[model samples]
Target: MRASAKIFWILGVFFLIVAIAYGFVTGTYEPHGIETVGFPAILALSGLGFMIAMALTLAYRKNSINPSDDLDAEVSREAGVQGSFSPYSWAPLWASLGAALCFLGVAAGWWIFAFGIMFAIYGVLSWVLEFSIGQHAH
Candidate 1:
């Protein structure tokens, strides 16, 4: 986690620098008819993402209970399963279908758009509750 914090800090600062550079470049450059606001905003948003990630990492590090920040501790002391992994599920397929419908709705009509939104919500809810009431759930 310490290593992750360090990495995040470095990346966040790097992106912030790049975003500032982008702002300066866009500010000084001449756009005949092209839009100049979006690119810099995107870059700035990317920097914000990195910065937010860094902040979250730092908060987690501070509140961490185990694995004391000891220099003498060997690296292998932290080896373990990091997270849970589902072996198989149909949730992804449903979610993907919903996303496809959303794309189609953008080109079709508002009725399709509304249906897509409802389908997408159902897919998300289905994914969240997939293991709650299923026979496969433990």
Candidate 2:
């Protein structure tokens, strides 16, 4: 995580520099229009956002160090039950179907949109409470 944060930070700085240089060059040719510098500006802003987010994560997680940060850390030391994860579930399929229906509704009619909304709600609720019922209850 530390390494990743550092990389993002560097990228952010690099993109910022590129954006500045691009703006300068483009400004010389076209003083009125922003079309030329928009892409680089977007890149610069995205990089800055990513860098700020990572910096915040590092600041917030002051004590939690990633295993990879330690040279002497062994694989076994890092290996453990990460968290609860569903091996298989129909939620994703339902959600996808709902999304498809919603898109179709946009081209079809409002009734289809209402159906999609209901289906999407069902998918989300079922996924959230999947383990609260049946054989997977806990």
Candidate 3:
């Protein structure tokens, strides 16, 4: 988790730099009412950085040491199942596709947005109950 946190922090900084560069390139020399690209990029990048800072702060409050982070830890200490993920699930793909459609529908039509909402709902529900109410139940 510490490694992940560091990676996100680096990404956050990189994004912040990119956003600043982008704003400069977009001719934001003086304050304006709004910008099509620069303002949103700055907001999103700063928000992402803030989110990572908050998440890392919260996680560190737990005070748990990661075996992987400990240089002196034994190799055997890391030899265990780490986390579980649904390998055979297609729900994520569907959900992402539905989300993409929803975004696209913003310029397309309300009908497309409605369909995307239904698709997203179905995908999310299937993902949640895939193991609880199916052959995969354990």
Candidate 4:
């Protein structure tokens, strides 16, 4: 779990850098709504978030509660549980679809701001769903 956390932190930073670069290259100076600050601000904020999450984990390392802490118990409990659960794999699919839709909306000039808003909602939903449900099922 600690390793996974470190990997996620690095991945988050990579995404943040790529997002900022994409915005700059496309000349979309503003990030959703933040004015003069622009995409750089968004990138910085994302990096900050990742850093904070990593810091939290490091700070709590002594008392860290990871899935491995109860590996056998968790495995046994899960072995007995059965149900038809929604596979959260669809969340990423939906989010990518939403991103495509957002791009088309921007290109067609059909509610330009709507794309940003929709993209934000889609991103949030995708992230929440993956974080809350995806890992447990697998």
lDDT of each: 0.71, 0.76, 0.78, 0.65
lDDT for model 1: 0.71
Question: Considering TM-score, where higher is better, how would the candidates rank from best to worst?
Answer: 1, 3, 2, 4
RMSD of each: 3.8, 4.2, 3.6, 10.4
Query: Per-residue lDDT of 31-126 in model 2, one digit per residue for the tens?
Result: 674455585666768677676868856764896777877788889877888899776788878877888889999999989988998888888888
Better of 3 and 4 by lDDT: 3
| Sequence-dependent TM-score of model 4 | 0.33
- Candidate 2, superposed: residue stretches over 4 Å from native: 14-32, 35-52, 107-111
Would you list the clashing residue pairs of candidate 4? none
Per-residue lDDT over 16-118 for candidate 4, one digit per residue giving the tens place of the 0 to 100 score: 8876676766565455543445567667767776876687567558665655445544655436445655554556565676677778777887785476568
* lDDT (C-alpha) at residue 65 in model 4: 66
List candidate 3 segments past 4 Å from native.
2-36, 74-76
The sequence of per-residue lDDT tens digits that candidate 1 reaches over residues 1-138 is 555666767777777777777666766774743237765675666677687677768677678634645667777878899886555777777777878888888898767777777777887887787777675565
In lDDT terms, how accurate is model 3?
Answer: 0.78
Q: TM per model?
A: 0.67, 0.64, 0.66, 0.33
Candidate 4 local lDDT, residue 110? 76
Tens digits of per-residue lDDT for model 3 on 1-138? 677677778777878887777767665555663457666867697778869876975786687887767879898987878786666888898888788889878889988988888889988988888888766776
Return model 4's CA RMSD, one decimal: 10.4
